[model samples]
Target: MKGPALRGDLVTPSDARYERARVAYWAQFDEVRPSAVAYCETPADVAACLAFCQDAGIPAVPRSGGHSLGGYSTTDGLVVDVSRMSRVGVRRAGDGITAVVGAGARQVDSLAALWKEGVVVPGGMCPTVSAGGFVSGGGFGWLTRRYGMASDHVLAAQVVLADGRVVRCSESVEPDLFWALRGAGGGNFGVITEYEMRPRRVPTIVSFHLRWPWDAAQAVIAAWQRWIIDGPDDLGSAMSVTAVGGDPATVDVAGGWLGDPAALERHLDELVGDAGRRPEIRTVQEDSYLDTMMAAFGLTDTTAGQRQWTGQNPDAVIPRQHFAVDRSVLVDRPIPLTGIGEVLAAFEREPRPGQVRLLSFFALGGQVNRVPRTASAYVHRDAQFYLAFWVGLDRDLPDEGDRHAAQTWADDGFAVIDRYSGGEAYQNFIDPALGGWREAYYGENYSRLAEVKRTYDPHGFFRFAQSIG
Candidate 1:
């Protein structure tokens, strides 16, 4: 059979930009070489690429921000790149604010636009992560504790299915597809063209960071768990223990609160009182919600417009290129103090000379847990916190032994935490090493998601190693 004619720009191996286009955010997957990259500028272009790939019997994958940790966005056959279709704006629906975001729109672009309208949506902290996979896979961030996951705010979406069918789905239309799209909707169903999100009013936030020495790691973690268990919905926080290149470990708690500075101070005081000690350093600042986001992305030191929504210095962006491996688990309850010590011990293990290790705990619960388990495809609504074990290797490390050492360290750390984990994981993190990932990522929702997979993609055309069905 003859392949469908291409409508968008087809970048073959002979093209000058093919090499750069094939690279993902993580340097570890730089070896994946697609046969061709189709840059789609419209929904029709997406449908055309799907038709061509289906006719040619070629495996195809969609690429937006290209931040897939498992490299699911790149295939050996065809790649539909939607990074060129990025557009973000606010549309007025009656007296409400609706955010119109293209699938390729980056978090920085969307957040900056929404900030100008005095509204914000829950999104990942990374500036360049695309809304396509992030919202579909149930995104979370600083605002999650107060507002809920990013997927909860999605009002609708436009998708191009495997058979070249273009459709708009929401609660009122194609309800089953809408249910699956909320949480497990990575690239499993189709290529997302755009998203319609409901925005919430932005409030004056108190951003704070408290740091303690390596010796206080256990105490800080123990106190954090107790504090977040009963913390207010307006307070969102995360605790991180980081060790860089054989350096001593550093423990820090950082986050933003949606209320006044006084309320935030009292919360901090309670945390310190529980820990029975004072942090070595602490800083709190009351700023606009946009500035707090800017600080999280490491853009606070940049020029004025670059840190705010002034429509200037738009080109000042951060590039994330690192050889990293990360594994995560969701905990339904706080780990015992002894288990916390074991986790800290794993962090203390010496990595390679140029390797950095991080153990992070993202606070959950509050509004996040108010939703029922079966309310959406996301089954981890009962989880209290999300924990991640990450290790970064310097790209310049030439020794194969050093790379293996870094991997071993990361795996060992993950194993230590897995013992106390709630046996569930976040779909957005996408771990390739996980076994029985269907049950791990989606608990009771796995069977339903697989059924949805059959209904939409019976031929299993949109698939990766860990994709549904």
Candidate 2:
């Protein structure tokens, strides 16, 4: 196998005209570029790159899609571009189905492989998100209410640590790293090459969408708080402040039920029945499990090597949501409207100076909640559901006003969030702005994680803004 330098072209900052390499997912900032992009094609290539960075005393980051909202994967140091390693393989073991997929694998690629077998795995809702980052960060989605987060179904991992050694971690061997790698995230301890995942059988379900006038924003938010408390585990629901018309003022509360159409209809009928004006659209359709997953991603089918994106994937909400934002708390209870106002204030200040959209995934007693906090590296056990403040920026909006609004909205939103969750933040979505992010990302387990970090990377070869010290 070829080394890191040969598998793909390397771009260094010393070169004068490499403009494209300097951008990230948000691409709003100028200094947000990597020192060198090490394009790797195989497991051996990844191992060699880590070794090179180790001996040379150069810090390294791992990039799959460059889709990270926090831009953690693309550090100013060396980056291992694993996007070229997207090879997917599957095997059926008796009644069970096991797939061995590469780290660069995207959601659509892996879901299609599983779909061919008439099976499903809990993955990201976005077609473009890479499996490595998605799983490493506690992945949640429509199927999450049924089988739990994507990390929960991880059976094993093929990991490459900082010191250039390859070891397989599972329930049976290297169990500590096994726990960390499943949910803690990649580049935290090592580079994950393959994931042995537990696949779930797809179900026939009903999907419902209720698009309401902008005036009904408060109504939908309150209704969801009540419905989710007693909703069925099979019914996975989320609400978004999406732009349905010319001006971005419409709200869409859409949910997926893993059961029959009649059952889902009854549930929606009971939940939103009190509201006088019901949504009249018939966007709901019943299909096979794979089709539903594709629909969840907003894509239909795929051609040869080209990626098919639905462009309607649901993303997590951040309180202060601007084109470029920071991470906040993950609370157990939905804040009162009076408090939500502060959140909206920050959202309005997005770099594009637009209103913030709040997205919530209600926790309706699922396998994820049943798993104890200490069971894995992801310790979000008491959480009733996941809350993400998702904001979209008008690329053409004036820079000064947008930044002002975005900052005010973020500062106000964080104030209220502090009242509820002890200033705890989600590590996965954090920006470089927070103080003691090691605690927010890892919680009380930060010290232990640092020990793990020291054990694996004694030379401090893989440091970053939020990495465990």
Candidate 3:
């Protein structure tokens, strides 16, 4: 509080960096009325807490590891809490290595501290995410189809602007706020402590998971959209249709892979070829690199402090049993095979018995499709993959027919996924009543990320829900 109050006015909020300004992880909207939370630890302590919240006008929220989910990293006013400035370094940039990290480093301790020095980047997949809002929204897990997203391995960023000024951008200092802080999606651009990345050298082996059923959600999501339009960008995968336990008709199909492990058992044997005889599989096989990231966090009897950024703040509730529940946002493409046969008959009628859940897909293109959707500031270069879905409501059924059975399977899965995926969405898995969100999160660099949010937040001091101005 006082000590962290950037420059003077050693006031109160009981100081000591506002007692570690707690709360994060799925931060329940404004965490029960927040107002006096401020904690930053350098980059001039976020330019003296953005000059003491612009001379005490008060309205802040930067939080790291606070894994945002529409709650824009939680707010209600003043909250800097840069997750106690955790660091993660790695040198040798010339032809391949560089890493500054810190922005509350945590995606599995910065990927097992850069794979025990072998190096790597393109992070995300829980490991308690928060490399500053997962590189401000262009996140990618499972080594991003071979090292790419995660703002495509950054390059530079030390930010801290909005009247506080602590520059150090890159591609040339302040190159339009380093191209809208790579994929411009974190609260409007400003306080970004550190991130310099450029690492590589992973894949000692990267086996992952799979849990299918509900008649293989449209043949494992249309064979993973034809295995990502002709897979092999080092193979990352996805196929979800969730609602486990209180299932509204179960369906799961998870995936992930990198290399070795006999090429991940021959790529899960061509990804469950012909979708036959493939069920009940849970192998956390490893080849090192920190025991394959401790088997992607499924560590025997897992409990990494019950995740969601320790400060405890999770809430995605809606249980009261079966009825109407609508939510849709689709962007489909030619791979719609009659909407995967009506999502295999509305997931086998209305499944529940032993619910299935697998929803997380990464693996679009190598080098993230040679990036080019405006280099960074993520414009989904014409997308290769990024899918999301979470629908589970059934307590005893009767809340208006569970919101009409979750909006009739979310309007039949966003109208067969927008007739072949193209409606463009993924602004960090959106959910602000699903508006266009700056054309599906910075696609077309949303006007040069709103002119780099008019140079480091021209008064938009890190806004959200359509951030870059």
Candidate 4:
């Protein structure tokens, strides 16, 4: 039987665009060639694509920025690529500004557009990550500690359901679905076309990057945790130890501060005192909100219009990952120095010849935890910080054996930190290998999410690996 007609363009296998269209952010899924890719341009386009997939008996997956760590953005079936729907607008809502953002809007574009209006949203640092997947998976970043997750600021959304009905959901309308969409994770419910978000207003920000010798990794990790755990909510920080190829590991701390430069310096001084070592490299600047965000991703030198994947725009500079193995844990309690040592030791082990290993800690709490776990579907309100371990292969030297070894290293490293994890993981990271993901991602809210899943997609049309059952 033939499928329903769609207004959007469809790229079939024979089309010249097929090869590029089928690729996701991570090259790991580069071989996942779908029957056709539907480049959705409107809600009607999304509805038509979903109906066609149903009529044709083919699985459909939504592709936004194509940044799914587990490669869930593309599939072997039909792909609803919404990258063409990128649009962002801001309007006054009482005393605040509401950002009307398209689901396919890239984080960099959205940030740049909103910054022009003197407002910002909590979003990831990845320049090319889309609003669709980011907000759906409970987005977090430099602004997260002060404001909250990106989903927390969502005022409303337009979703194209499985039945071809375009519904706008919010706190008052389709409240149950609204609850689930916040943190239930994307691609499980319906395809989001647009979002209405209340963005935070900020006039200035202090951005800083500090680094210490690899020998100070343990002190940095230990003191960083204590500093963030007891620090004010206005502060946001990410501390990481990274080793690329044969280079020695480097311990780095970087983030944005809402306060002035003097206060930020005092905070850094405290951190340095606690760690008992001054940073070997330090760069602090009082910059605009937009500059701080761009600096986070090393895109301060590029224009927002130029910070996309080269596949999307030839002039864009952001490059896609070849392959990666990522694992995460939500730490409610601080890991002792011994456990921290174990984490560092695990990270230093099995250093491959052509791999980049990274261990990151993103501070949680503040406004993120101020909300009750039951307030929304995002239930990890008690976490003090987020701990993640990942290994990426050199794009030039892709190897299946190296990939396997990287996964093994990630698993073992994750195991070390998992001992201190509060039995939860960041849904945004979305690990395919995570055991008990239903509980790890949603915690006490899984049952309610499953119920929402039944209500909206009882037939399991919108399903993927680790989707709500």
lDDT string for model 4 (1-469, tens) is 2444667788888888888888888877877889888888889989988888888789999999888888888888889998888889887758766889999998888888888777887788788899999998888888888999888999998999999899999999999999898887599999998999988878788888899989999999899999999998889999989999879999999988989889999999999999999999998998778777777777978965578677766777887888888899999988999999899999999778889999989988999999999888899999999998988888655777887899999999999999999999998899999999988999899999999989998899999888997
Task: Tell me the TM-score of model 4.
Answer: 0.97
CA lDDT of 236 in candidate 3? 69
The per-model lDDT (C-alpha) reads: 0.85, 0.66, 0.62, 0.88
- Which portions of model 1 show Cα errors greater than 4 Å? 1-8, 301-317
Per-candidate TM equals 0.95, 0.86, 0.32, 0.97
In Å, residue 16's CA in model 2 sits off its true spot by 12
- The C-alpha stretches of model 4 lying farther than 4 A from their native spots are 1-4, 93-96, 303-305
Which candidate achieves the best lDDT against the true structure? 4
Displacement of the residue 283 alpha carbon in candidate 4, Å: 1.9
Residue range 1-469, candidate 2, lDDT tens digits? 1225556666676655345554545545445666777767777778888887776766778887666666676766678878777777767778667777677888888878767776777876677777788887788777776788788888888878877788888899888777777667657888887788887777566777777765666666667766765677787877765531135566677767887788777777775664455764536677776777766765666453435222212232211212645445666676677766655454444333244444433443466777886677777765655555544455533376665655555555566555666445655566576676666666766666677777776776666666666
Model 2 lDDT-worst window of ten: 312-321
> Could you give candidate 1's per-residue lDDT for residues 1-469 as a string of tens digits?
2333555688888888777767777767767888888888998899988988887889889998888988888888888888777788889868877988888888877888778888877888888798999999999888899889999988998999998898899999988888898999888999998989988887668889999989988989999999988899988899999988878889999998988898899999999999888999999999888878877898765753453222223554555456787888899898999999898888887656778788999988889899998778887888889998888876643367776776788788889888887899999999999877888888898889889899999999999999998
lDDT of 3 by residue, 292-324 (tens): 666656543344354333333343121111222
